[model samples]
Target: MKPSNTIKELLDILNSNRIGGVPVVDDKGQLVGMVSDGDVLRYLAPKPLGIAGLVYIIEEQ
Candidate 1:
């Protein structure tokens, strides 16, 4: 997978391939790193103070 690929794209690949993770590559196709399902979930998960941050943002808006 490329670094610029979206989460949906990666998830699709993982699901279709029945894999747990994927290797992230650059434009040149060199392996840069790997991303697992856990990593993606963690990234998408809410932060500890997410509600407070959302409240502040709503008030600001």
Candidate 2:
């Protein structure tokens, strides 16, 4: 897949092909890297705010 592909496009390719990951290529078609389903999931997953959330709450009061 091209490096410029969007997350949605990547997901579509993965799902349609029933694959876990795909190789990312540059404009010249050289292998740049690989993107796995786990990688995308981690990227899309909500990050924990932890202490930062508490600090924000305290400051707002």
The alpha-carbon RMSD values of the candidates against the true structure, listed in the order shown, are 7.3, 9.0
Candidate 1, residues 1-61, lDDT tens digits: the string is 9999988898899889999999999988899999998676666555654667656643652
Most accurate candidate by TM-score: 2
Candidate 2 per-residue C-alpha lDDT over 1-61 given as tens digits, one digit per residue, 9 for 90 to 100: 9988998899899989999999999999999999998787556444655666656643653
Output the number of the lDDT-best candidate.
Answer: 2
Q: How many backbone clashes does candidate 2 have?
A: 0
Question: Which consecutive 10 residues in model 2 have the weakest lDDT in total?
Answer: 52-61
C-alpha lDDT of all candidate models, in order: 0.79, 0.81
The TM-scores of all predictions, comma-separated, are 0.70, 0.72
